[model samples]
Every structure is written in C-alpha cells, then in structure tokens.
Target: MEALNQPLQVELGPLRERMGIGDLLRYERLAGIPLRRRFFVALTGVLLLAIAMLVALVWLDRTGILAQAPVLGIFAVGYAVLAAVGFVWYAIDLTRRARLALFAWVNGWAYADSLEGTRRPGSAFARTLRSRERGVVASDDERLPFELGRNFSIGTRDWGATVQRPFAFVELPLPVKVPHIVLKNRRRSIIPTLGLGRGGARMELEGEFAKHFLLLVPEGYQQDALYIFTPDLMARVIDLGAGAEIELVEDRLYVYLPGGTRFDRPATMEATLRLAEEFQRRFAARTELYRDDQAGDLAARAGVAIGLRGQRLAGSGVSLMAVAATAGVLLLSAGVTAFSLFGGDLLRAWGAG
Candidate 1:
C-alpha cells in the first residue's frame, strides 16, 4: 500500500502546483458559456422574438383589425416593450463579458508589476527581457509615459505631455530559421499586430500582459520551443533550426508566439538562455537612460505647470453630465411612447378630449 501511494503522491504534486486561486475563479465564471456561445444565444433570442412579432402582425391584418386605432395602439405598446427588453438584455450581456475581459487583462498586468519589486538582481525574473525594451512611467499629479508610446510619435497635446528617453536596451539574436518574433509587456499594452522592423525585415511579436512585466516572444513560436530561466520566469526563445512559420499575438504587456517546431535537446536551452541573458542586460540599461532623460525634462517643465488638476476634474464633470443627459432623453422617449399607447385609451374611455 505504501509503494502504491508513493506514485499517487508524486502525480498529485504536479497537479497541485499547477492549480491556483485565480484559475479557480476564471473557471467558475467561464464554466459553461464561451464568448462565442454567449453571442449566439443572445442573437438567437432576438431573431425568435422578431419572427414571433412578424407572425402576430400578419394575423392582426388578416383579421381586418390592423387599422383599428385602439388595436394598433396596443400592438405598438407590445412592440415597444419587446424592443426594450431585448435591448436591455443584449446590453447587460455584452457589458458583463466586456467587464470580465477588462478585469482579466488588468489583473494580469498588476501581477507582473508586483513581481518587478520582488525580482532578485542577477535572477531571471529581475532582468528585463528583450521584448519589453520599453517601460511605462507616470507621476502622481499628472502625466503618463505610456500614452506617448500609444501614438508612437512626439508632439505636444493635452493630458500632460512629456518626453521619454530610453534608459536601457536589449537585443536578441535570431535563429536563421526564425523569420518573425514578438515582444510582450506584462501589462499587455503592446499591440501584437504591429511589427518591429529589424535589418529591413519585419519581425512580428505577440504580447502578453501579466502582473510584473510585459512579455514578448516570437509570434507562433511552439510551446515546447520556449522556456524561462530557473527561478526567474525571464522567457527565452528556443531555436528549432527550421520548418513552420512563426506568428504573433499581442495583448497588454505580453506576447505569444506559436506554431513553431519543437526543441529536442538540452543544447537548445543553453543557446537560448545565453541570448536571453544578453537581451536582459541591454534592456535594463535602456530603461535607466530613459528615466534619466524624463527626469531632466520634468525638471524643466516644472516652471510651466499650471492648474492641470482642475482642468481634468472639469472635463470629467462635463463628460458625466453629457452621459446623464443622454440617459434622461432615452428614458423620456420610452415613457412617452408607453403613455401614448396605454393612456390614450384610458382618456378616450373616460370621455376626455
């Protein structure tokens, strides 16, 4: 019995290591309904309701009561109710899924950021990977560096403009067989479809945003072809030599590379690790340079600082007011339609003009 139990215990260890609290929550929420399934369910419900309404309209016409004022009024009210219900249901369902996706994306990015503070120097996790080549910086009162990268060009604009200087740089040597690569941020901020040009060849990367740092990898790189350094999770690109095209998908701060051939030997890991280390060192240097440049720019602009906080607050208030006004209009329109159909009959029956 002891011998048999030993093997079972060993098997369970790996399973337990793979399980996490976040995984459980995600499983619970996505248990039965997939994104595509939810969309289909809502679409089918609306189509069925439309068909039923059409059938009812046809029946009313055949009965020669389609033009009867009171009857038409009732039909209009019923139609309005159906429309409202459908709209509400669709909106609720869409909002729920969008919220879920956004939540997951943000949580993942936060996790990566937290890891940044905990990373040990000379450890894999502590070092920046080649893909992240960039970092986001922000101030307490105003200005965010990430927004500048979003536009990918320098110009003066609202929301507090600031220039970024590269503090460090990291470079990865590509395998002759690997045609495309991706870079990802743990925050999933980098767009995947945007290809980075290197040596006149466009290298594609997929981004993945997680809690500590952004991850980048060659798009469509095989699962088995990549590995992280021990105790660090600093990702590496394993060279498979040949066969299959690489693809990238970028989300948040991480990139996913898939559709690559497998690595068969320890030698592959060694070669990849070497490249990963070099890339990491370069990236750290680049970040330092960027921070230094930004600090200087901030000091210069300190004199020009005006009441930006107040402006932001006022803009937010105006936006809220507009949203409230729109909602009020929609509600008023719906209420008027309802009253016109239902109250019209009540007034006529009471002999009111």
Candidate 2:
C-alpha cells in the first residue's frame, strides 16, 4: 500500500515552459537514491580528472604553447569519452527501470528494484549460487511470478572465477516434489573438466531432441522424467532456445542462458519471459496438488516470510566413473614404473640369449 502511494510516475519526459507550481508538484519531489548515487560517482570522477589535468598542465611547461593543442586535445577526448559512457549508462539504466515498472504494472503485480522481503537462508540456490545484488522480484499476485535479475555472478575462482549472466525464471509450484532433471546442448564442451562431464544417469527422450540435447535425470526418476517432459513439451523447449540449458530441480523449471548475455534489450527479455511462461503452463497440470499447500496459505494469512526456493539440483551427485578413471590412472602409472625398473635386466637377458 505504501509503495503504491509513495509516488505515481517516473516522469522522464519534459515539455514545460515556466511550469506552474501544481504541474511541478505533481512529479515526484526527489529521484531515487540509486540515481543520486550514480550522479555523485560520475561527478567525483570528472572533478578528479580535471584537477589532474590542471596539475599536469602547470608541471609540463617544457612543451611550449605549440604543443598545448595536442596535450589539451588528449584531455578533452578523455573527458568526452568518460561523459559519453556515463550518459549511455544513465540512459540504459533509466530505460530498464521504466520497462520493469511497465512489466509489473501490466501484470498487476508489485515491483521492487531490489529483492522484496525474501530471505531464504536454508536454500542453497539463493544462499550460495545466485548473487544477491539488485535482484528484482514481482510477487503479491495470484500467479506468484518470477524474479528477473541482470548481472548475476556465480562460479568459483578456479572455474573461470566470477562470471556474470542474466537469469530470468519463474518458479513452478509443484505440489508433489519431483527429482532433478537437466537438458544440456550436446555439441559444445560447456563445462571445463578433465574428461567427460558426468551429469547423472542420462535420460534419452524420443524424436530429434536427442540430436540436439542430452537429458540427464536422477536414477529413480527416469520414468517420471519422461512423463513430465512430454513429446510436445520437448519440442516447445527446443523451439524456446537451442543454446539454452533447461533444468528441473524439485519444482522449479530453470532456463540458463550462456554467461555474458544481457537482458536489457526488449527482445531478449521477451524471449526469456515467453519460454518461461510456456514451461510453467505446460507443467501446471502435471504438478499434483497436495494438502500441504494449506500451510503456505496459513502462513500467508499469518504474514510469515517466504524463503527462496533452493534450485541447486542436489548436484549431479558426483561420478563413480571419475573415481574409476583415477584408479585406472594409478594402475597404469604402477605398470610404467615396473617396466622402467625391470627393462635393463630383461634387455641384458635377451642379448645374452
């Protein structure tokens, strides 16, 4: 209620000539804190650069008046580039905020520039996997929509360090929990591993799906996985994005795009949202409703906080093949050492014979 009442418009446009007090008062009195912070940072950078240029100009007097043009031109170009970059960033961010607002408004859901009161400590996905910086979620609607985040960084220092990616997903409310399932592209070596990257027991689906993607599911859930991802759904998923990887952990359907993809563009956002929405709709009937949902309903009535859903896939759960390979390596090493030690004696015996 308070968020809605706070201020009505973003008010980016202007066509005023000595605007009246009433017209001026209608717009929000103050810009948001983030805009102010950005302005301050840019201002500080320009000021520091100007001071440095002035000091350099005084100290480097040997250049004479003739060389001043080139030197001044360098400084001017530097400043211009900095200012242009700042302006571009400002324009992009402002447009992004407006689009987010429009998305929330059209869907009749509340929007926040940051996470909205969701603190899921127990969940490994939110607590560990995804970054918590400037995540936006739209909830308070019947649909219980998705959280779209830009520049979410995840990964270890060893595995290419911190990689930023755009993640857009909607949580599928599964009444009966399901096993983890993943569909990855087959062509490229997506993961950096010594040998083959094991992703649990491979669940091969019918038709052309196998040609493009390799589906992996937990041991017990192969049959259920087949049933869950029907032939029609498989075709639709393929159509969604050929390069993207789709994952199912418990209840959530996640479409993970390659790292370094940006969601600021309308086309990108549209495609992401369209695919996610399709998945949600397709899986709706399959998720069997349970009486346990009432606990959530009761909590909602009681105003209890909701934790973030853990989408860590329980992992591929490691591989016995990897351990087997390691053992094989050790045996080969031992055999090589034995040959190295015994070769002299064997060679001498053969010559004597």
Candidate 3:
C-alpha cells in the first residue's frame, strides 16, 4: 500500500487540525463515508450529552432552587467549551488514522485499520502472558518505511502487577546470525522488565555504551554477542533509540517503543525509522541469508539437570572421569599382551633358578 503523495507537515497537519467545513469537504472527498461516519458518531454522543444537560436545567428551573437565565447561559457556554474539546479530540483521532492510512499508501506499504486478523501467526506480537495482557487494543501497522507493528497492549511483569506496555516496534533483520540479546537503558528503569529481564547472562560493554545500558546475551555466546554489538553499532544504537530497548531474538531485531504507535508524534516516528534504517544499513553485509537447511534442533543439544561431577561433562553424553578410566584400562591390557609374548625367556630363567 502507498500513501498519497502529500506534504505531511505543510498539507496534512494543518488540514487535520483546521476546523473549517471546507477541510471536511476535502476529507470527505478523500476518505468518502468513513470520515463522515466518525463525525456522526461523535456528534451523536455530544447530542445525547446535551439533551441530558437540557433536562437537568429544566428540572432546576421547575424546582426554583436556582432561577437565573444568566446562570444557565454561563453554564451552557462552559459546557460548549468542554464539548468542543471532546469533539476536537475525536476529530483529531479520526484524521490521524486517515493520515496514517494515506501515509502508508504513499510509502508503498500495506496498512490496516486494526491489528486483528492482520497479525502474522507465530509473530512476537501475537504471543502474550495472560495475566499481563490488555484486551483488544487499537492497532495500525504499516509494512512500508519499515516493518513497523503495534500490538495495543504488550503485557509486562511490572511490580508484581500486569502492566500494559502499548508498544510500537520496527523490525530490523540482521545479516549475521546472532544469538538473542537485549540492550536496555539502565537509566530508564531500575528493572529491565520489557527486555524480558536478565534471562541469561548480563554483560556490561566497554566505554560510554556500558554507562548507558545493560546488555544480556545467551550463555556461551558472549564473544559472538560482542562481535555483533561493536562499539560503533552500540554507539549508533544509543544515538538512535529515544530511550527505548533494543531486543534481538533470533533473526528479528526489534526496536521497542514505550507507548502505542499512534501516540508517537511525527518527529518521534521519523527518528525511530531513521535509527532502524541506519542499523540495518550498517549490518547489511554481515547478514546471512535465511535458508531452511540452516535450522537446527539447538534446544535438544543444550545441557539439562544438576550433576555431581557430571556438570563438568554436561551435553557431551559421557563423563571426563569415565573417559580417563577407559583409557587407563586400554593401556594396561596392551602392556599385559606385550608381557605375555616377551616373558618366554623370563619363564625359562625362573625355572633354572
């Protein structure tokens, strides 16, 4: 899908926040019935609230507790201001969706009004921890510019309660096959909950990068992890991230934003995309092309269970002590065979004695 070629700041921004019927005509022409439907829905809600207010005013008048037309006029004016605020908010929300839809189209990306039925199966966004999940959130994901997706409520284990992290993510596919790693800004939160916490080993990198973030990587892959996160890359990550976490799980490198995608102003969106693009560009040569043959049952091979001395030989299926003992027996048997053949002269000497 592609958004129509329009200057977003010069054209789209003003037209949206503008409150003239002329702008509605433009919106109606572009969006047709959808824009109108939203307006009517908001209008209906305000109308009902107005009716309730009117009834209250009539009740007050009949009771003679408060008599004045002037008092009611002032209250009506205040209510109108409140109603305008509500209407403006509703209009802005609707217009933004329309803008985003068009924006996606212009950029040669697909756009969906919501994430439901659009979410790819087995995607990270589709999985959630039940207790932390927030139900059915509004989502608008576009494929163009980047694989940017938002799942309304990404659940987290926050302070022993289920917290909704309405997250927006830009997926960066790395050229190299790197183990899952997470780099979270230490200054942002005391606990790196959204980085999925410290799952394996927490690594502190060298230089200013180390000062800003705590890196977590899988066991035995510390060197490989370091290779991927070079000082330059780390610097770029820090420079680009607007204080969000960078999570690398398998091939998918996710730049996780704190709030819903819609909450991002245009500037934030631009910065995020810019950062993701830069990272992708720097790592393009290193990225390995995906193939089904490359897949392996790595989990089946990792060690499990506690061991006495066995921990030393884990994942090898045999103990180091067993190998040593077996070698010792083999050497002894070979010596005995040599002695049997060579002892003939020794036996005769012993008989003479």
Which residue segments of model 1 deviate by more than 4 Å? 1-31, 34-37, 109-353
Which 10-residue window in model 2 sums to the lowest lDDT?
8-17
- When sorted by TM-score, best at the front, the candidate numbers are 3, 2, 1
Highest lDDT: which candidate? 3
Name the lDDT of candidate 1. Answer: 0.31
TM-score per candidate, in order?
0.21, 0.58, 0.59
Worst 10 residues of 3 by lDDT: 309-318
lDDT of 2 by residue, 168-273 (tens): 4344444444455667667532322122224446766667988878766544455666777778877887898677666665555555555444444556656666
Better of 1 and 3 by lDDT: 3
Please state the error at residue 172 of candidate 2 in Å: 3.8
Off by over 4 Å in 3: 1-37, 64-84, 117-145, 154-160, 175-177, 189-199, 260-269, 286-353
Go through the candidates in order and give the clash count of each: 68, 0, 10
Which candidate gets the maximum TM-score versus the true structure?
A: 3
| Model 1 poorest ten-residue lDDT run | 141-150
Q: Which residue pairs show collisions in model 3?
A: 1-109, 2-105, 2-106, 3-102, 3-105, 3-106, 175-286, 175-287, 175-288, 176-287
Candidate 1: tens digits of C-alpha lDDT, residues 1-353:
44422311111121112323355345335433355445455566666776777777777778877867557747755885776587666554344333333332432311111012322111111222221211221112111111100111221233111212122211222211221223333232222222222122222223421233322232232221132221133332222211111121111111121212011112432332343344334333322222112223554377422122111111110122334565799999999999888987988878964
